[model samples]
Target: PIPNSYWATPLLLACEYPWTPANPNKPKLDAVLHAGVRTFIDLTENGELRPYNGEVLATRAEFLGIDRQAIEYHRFPIHDRSLPESIEFMYSLMEVLRDNERRGRITAVHCRGGIGRTGMVIGCWLVESGRARNGEEALAIIAQKWKTVAKCNKYPHSPETGAQAEFVLHFE
Candidate 1:
């Protein structure tokens, strides 16, 4: 378990396996290790890495000795199970990134298919990193990067309830 910082938890929650093969692609594993991935974040609220059981696969990767210290799990309860929960998860991700930036650690974030939940987290990253001006811009950038669809608002706005995007835009 990693330290319980405002940031770390969200990152763990941001964990998703979008591009990686269902059972840890060998080539991808090489690239991940090369990238200095100190930890793996699991952001799914259900905490179940569907399709291929991410937890089991990651544990196997650990057994194989691929920087096992980097694997960490963070879980957030998805009470709403709707748009609001999705947005809340993104805020948690922002905290994790901020904390990591301060500690100088590089992390990879993902969700199920790396689309809906995954896109939200990356959108927060763009805004927090100042790569985008606002949530709208952040959404656009994420969509471009991952080709995701975040259709919460009539347009592609961040979820309205979490107040996370609004809060992070000012603070970060």
Candidate 2:
């Protein structure tokens, strides 16, 4: 798990799909509810949701006591770098996060593995928020945070590709 100190707002969490069988120990809906994460930002395409242990995104959010509307799905293709449209999506995500934070709610952002696409967005946020000077620095902070979390859970997490890295650098 990511230490609270790694975040500007401790409520912002980067994660993978929690219902998959591959991660038996992953947090369940109840755990997410307890953690106060009311908003879920999904970066994967809609088509990918079916393979996630057969649980649909809207249904999972309902199970967690969250309204289906609170679960925002921004269909960013996996492995590929962000395009011009992706920047627009990032801006929109910022608005969602800001709104949620104002309401005293936490937000969780995830892709399939929650490494590449998730990390890219988080890194963009870090830089845009002035938590880091640039995308490279933002990504370095994310990598370090992932390393710390990985040491405890043994889950491999980091920005997974150079394309993602470059996208973050040019995201502004």
**lDDT by residue for model 1 (1-172), tens:** 1111112122322223533455455444445434455544545556354432356546545656765555544444332213335555556756777777677665655444333444455566767777678867765544343323333233343322344344334433
Error of 1 at 110 (Å): 1.1
In candidate 2, what are the lDDT values of residues 71-123, reduced to their tens digit? Answer: 54444444433432656767877777777767776777777666677778788
TM-score of 2: 0.70
**Alpha carbon lDDT at 66, candidate 2:** 70
Candidate 2 accuracy as lDDT = 0.63
Residue ranges of candidate 1 with Cα displaced over 4 Å: 1-31, 50-67, 77-81, 84-90, 147-172
Estimate the lDDT of model 1.
0.46
